[model samples]
Every structure is written in structure tokens, then in C-alpha cells.
Target: MTMMTLQDDLTTAAAKGNTADVESLLRRGAAVNGVNRFGRTAVQVMMMGSWPVAQALLQHGADPNVADRSTRTTPLHDAARTGFVDMVRLLVAAQADPQARDNQSRLPVDLARENGHAEVVAFLETLK
Candidate 1:
């Protein structure tokens, strides 16, 4: 298969929370940091609710801080926006930048608070 196809499969696997598929793709030399059609890497796609997939991607060298091309939204931003504490922890341990801004100059913490995620707000406050 083409390199682009492998990358697309990797992102799709992560998005679907299929860790086995993700690991398989990585073993086949898929680009861990490759952006899919949505301008998000595998780890960024996993940030929606799949910490295991995110971790798998990270272990395979997916860049935790990689941002969406249009919004500049990193995995941390997605995790915090949805109050996904485990995802936040995973990204933080992977060295994601909590202060990184998006296209709107909004940080992850801002997104959390805007969504009424108090626990996420407190956690991010400690990081700052």
C-alpha cells in the first residue's frame, strides 16, 4: 500500500479505538505523525475518547503536540475541551504543551472552562 494510505489507516484505527489495528499499522511503518483528511494526527484523533489508542500512538512515536493544520488544536485541547482527564494525563506525560493556542488564541484550559469542566480547569490550573 502507499505511505499515505498507511497513514490514513493509522488515523482511522486510532479514531475507532482499534488498538490492534493501530499497532499493526505502526509495525508496518506507518507515519505516526501523519495528518489525516481532518488535519489531525493519530494521537489527536484518539484524544476524543481513546486514551489507549493515544498511548499506543505515542509509544509508536506519534507526536503528542502535533496540531491540526487549520485550528492548531493539539490533543491536549481536545482532551480538556471534553473533560477527558485520562486523556489529558496521557498527553501531558507525553509532553504536550498545555499553553498551546488554537486558531482562535484559545488554550486547552479555556476550552475546558467554556465547556464547564471544573475538574479539567483545576487540573490545568495546577499545570500553569
Candidate 2:
């Protein structure tokens, strides 16, 4: 398979929350930070509730702060937006930039608050 295929596969596996596939792809030379055809990295599209997937990607050097092409939203933004506090914690542990602003100039905490995720919002606020 081509390098691009590996990247796409990795992203797909991560999005599906398939930790084994994600780890296999990484070991097979898939770039941990590689973007797919959608211009999103594995971490960017990973299932927010899947901590094992997130952990595997992060351990393989996936960039926790890598922003989306159009919105500039990081993995932290997605996690916070979805009210997945565990995913947010995983991203933060990987050094994700909580202050990263999206195209709307909104922080991850802002998304959490907007989405009615009080716990996520509170958790992010404490990092400041």
C-alpha cells in the first residue's frame, strides 16, 4: 500500500475506535500525524470517547494540537465540543494547546461551555 493509504487507514481505524488497527498501522509505518484526504489527522478524527485509541495515537507521536485545515480546531476542540472530558484529559496530557483558537476565535473551553459541558469547561478552566 502507498503511504497515503496507510495514513487514510490509520485515520479510519482511529475514527472507528479500533485500537488494534491503529497500533498496527502505526507500526507498519503510518505517520502518526499524517492527514487524510479530508485534511484531518488521525487524532483530529478519532472517536472522542475512545481513550485507548487516543492514547495509542498520542504514544505514536500524533500531534495533539494539530489544527483542522479550515477551522483550525484542534483535537482538544473536538473533545471539548463533544463533552468528552476523558478525551480532553488525554489530549491535555499529550500537551494539546487548550488556548488554540478555531476560525471563530473560540477556545476549547469556549466550545465546552457552548455545548453545555460544565464538567469539561471546569476541567479546562483549571488549566489556565
Candidate 3:
């Protein structure tokens, strides 16, 4: 398959929480940070759940800070909003910016707080 197809497939796999497929695509040289037409990277989509898939992507060099073009929301934003504490931690370890502001100029901590993710809030506060 073409490199573009691999990338697009990787994005789809991530969205569906298919960790094995993600690993396969990566092994075959898919661009780890590849985004779709909307600039939605695999890392960002994987943030919805399936830490295993997210971890595989991250381990394979997916960028945790690549934001969506429309929302300017990074994987960190999604992780924080969803109260995925472990995902947030993993993203941070991958060098995601906790203070990154989206199109709405809101930080990850703000999202965590608004979403009632107290642990995420407390963790992000330390980064500021």
C-alpha cells in the first residue's frame, strides 16, 4: 500500500482502538504523526480511550502535542477532558504541553476542571 494509505489506516485503527493494526502500520513505516484532512492525528483520536493503542502509538513516536486544525486541541486536551489520568501522564512524559491553549484559549487543566477531573486538575497545576 502507499504511504498515505498506511497513514490513513493508522488513523482509522487508532480511532477504533486497534492496537495491533496500529503496531503493524507503524512497523511498515507509517508516519506516526499523520493527520487526516481535518488535522486529527492518531494520538488525538486514541485519547478517547484504549490506552494500549495510545501507548503503542506513543511508543512508535506519535506526537502527543499535534493539535487538530479546527479546534487546536491536542491529545493532552482530550486526555484531560476525559479524565484519563494515565493517558495524561503518558502524554506529559511524551513532552505534551500542559499549558497549550486551544482555539478557545483554554488549557488542559481548565478542561480537566470543567469536566470534573480533579486528579487531572491537580496534576496539571503542578506543570504551571
Candidate 4:
């Protein structure tokens, strides 16, 4: 397959939360930081509920701080927006910047609070 196709596949697998496929794609030399057709890295589109997928990407050197091309929101922003606290934790462990702002100039904690994720808001407050 073409390199672009391989990279897209990696992002697709990550988005699907198919950990095995993500791992296999990584093993096949998919660029851990490759952006898909949407110009988003796998970590950017990865399923919010799949910590294993996040872990695989992080271990493979996926940049935890990469902001979305349009929204300028990092993976942690997405996780916090979706109320996936575990995913937030995983990204933080991988050195995601909690203070990173999006196009709206709102932090991940702001998104978490806006989404009514009290636990996530609480967790992020401790990091400040």
C-alpha cells in the first residue's frame, strides 16, 4: 500500500478503537505521527474510550500535544470534551499539555466543565 494509505489506515484503526489493528499497523512502520486525510494524527482521531489505543500510539511516539488543524485542540481537549477521564489521564501521562488552548482559547478543563464532567473538572483543577 502507498504510505498515505498506510497512514490513513493507522488513523482509521485508531479511530475504530481496534487496538490489534493499530498495533499491527505500527509494526508495519506506519508513522506514529502520520496525519490522515483529515489532516489529523491518529491520536487526534483515536476513540476516546480506548486507553489501549492511546497507549499504543503514545508508546509508538505519537505526539500528545498535536492540536487539531481546524479547532487547534489537542487530544486532551477532545478527551476532556468527550468526558473520557481515563483517556485524559492517559494523554496527561504521555505529557499532554493540560494548559493547551483551543481555537476558542479554552483549556481542557474548560471543555470538561462545559460538558458537565465534574470529575474531570475536579481532576484537572488539581493539575493547575
Candidate 5:
């Protein structure tokens, strides 16, 4: 089997909420926007449900607008999927595209609604 690339390891660790590993990897020159085979970056993976990891990745230069391959999902999409209101706010504050659409043409707000996050759906409305 081939050794895991730094980007792959970083994304997996971030998805699993390993902040220390993410930090060490970033400090060691891991690309913040590096994509794995799934086109998911450390930021998107970390943004799943961990605000601290997402914030750390952002502070380390992770691009909020980086899109995945299939859905072209952004960190905002991941944050919305997890119903993380704070992370959503942070991404919006960082100028994340509120109108960014996935392959299914679903925006972050749409995902928030579909996921039944009333507060998030309301918050997105205010943004628009």
C-alpha cells in the first residue's frame, strides 16, 4: 500500500477532530487547501462539527471557498451540514460565498433548511 500523503493525513486527522495533528502538519508545511481524492481539504473535513479545528485551519490559511470535486462543497457547506452556527457565522464573516452552489445546486442555506436547523435557516435568511 502507498504511504498516506501529508494532505490525506491532514484531512483525515481534521475530520476526526485531531487538532494537534492538524497544527503540527500545518506547522510542517502541509497545504491548507490540499485536496484528497475526494477533493476535500483539511478545512472542509475539520469544519464538519469542530469549530476549533475549523478556526485553526482558517487561521493557518485554509481557504473557505475551496470546493470539493463532486459537489464542489465548501467549508461553509460542511459547517451547515453539521449545524454549527458559530462556524457558519465565522465563514460568513470571512467572506465565504453565501451563494456557492454544489453539484446538486444546493447552497449552504438549503442544506441548513433540509437538515432542520431552524436557527441556521433563519440566520441565512438574514444574510440574504
Candidate 6:
């Protein structure tokens, strides 16, 4: 059987919320900013609602500003979509572009508002 590539394991670990495995893979030379078939990095995967896994990835040097392929959506965009206030704050503190827009020209705040995440929308408004 062929062994899984580091990027593949990292993506799977992020998706599964496997913090320990993610950390291990990261320490074993996994690319913290590795992009999957969807152009999502480990950090983006974590922003998809896996806070613990995201935190682990972030601590390991995952780039919060990494953009997806088509939409160019950052991890902050994923955080907003999921209403993860802590993740949003972490991404912001990590220097994520507060005004970064997707292919549709929608910013993270716009997405939060569209998704009815009042608290997230309010926080994003404060950023501007």
C-alpha cells in the first residue's frame, strides 16, 4: 500500500479534528499551508469548525491568510461562515486581511451578515 503524503494526512487530520495526529504530522514535515484538491489548507479546514484542530494547526505555523483557489477565501472567511468568534479573532490577530474579499467580492463580514451570524457581523463591523 502506498503511504499517505504529508499534505494528505494533514488535510484528513484537520477534517477529522485529530489534533494529535495533525500535530504529529506537522512535526514530521507536513506543510502547514498545504492545499488540498479544493485549495483549502489545514488552517482553512480548521476554520470549517474544527477549533481544536485549527488551534493546533495555527500553533504549528499555519497561515491564516492562505486563500482558496476559486473563491480566494481566507481562513477568516471560513470562520465567519461557521460563526467561530474565537477562530475569527485568532485569524485577525494573526494578521489576516480584515477586508479580504472572495471571488464574488464578498468580505468576511458580508458573509457573516448573510449567514445571520449577528455577533460575528457585529464584531466584523467593529474591525472596519
Instruction: Estimate every model's Cα lDDT from 0 to 1.
Output: 0.84, 0.92, 0.85, 0.93, 0.83, 0.81
Error in Å for residue 95 of model 2: 0.7
lDDT of 5 by residue, 66-96 (tens): 8877668887887787798988988888788
Clashing pairs in 6: none
RMSD to native for every prediction?
A: 2.4, 2.1, 2.6, 1.9, 1.6, 2.0
Please write out the lDDT profile of model 4 over residues 14-121, one tens digit for every residue.
999999999999999899998887788899999999999999999999999999878899999999999999999989989999999999999999999999999889
Assess every candidate by TM-score. Answer: 0.90, 0.94, 0.89, 0.95, 0.89, 0.88
Residue-level lDDT of model 6, residues 1-128, one tens digit each, is 75667787889888887888998998899889877655577786662666678778778777788778767888898889879787778778778898998999989998888889898889888988
Looking at model 1, residue 16 earns an lDDT score of 88
Against the true structure, whose lDDT is highest?
4
Q: What would you estimate as the lDDT of candidate 3?
A: 0.85
Q: Candidate 3 residues 28-87, lDDT tens each?
A: 988888776546678877736688988898888877878877889988999999998988
Model 5 spans > 4 angstroms off: none
Provide backbone clash counts, one per model: 0, 0, 0, 0, 0, 0
Per-residue accuracy of model 2 over 80-109 as CA lDDT, tens digit each: 999999999989988999989999999999
Residue 10 lDDT in model 5?
91
Range of the 10 consecutive residues with the lowest summed lDDT in candidate 5: 43-52
Tens digits of per-residue lDDT for model 1, 6-96: 8788888887899899999999988898777666678877736777888788887778888887788888998999898888888888899
Q: What's model 3's lDDT at 19?
A: 87
Total backbone clashes of model 2?
0
- lDDT of model 3 at position 111: 93
Better of 2 and 3 by lDDT: 2
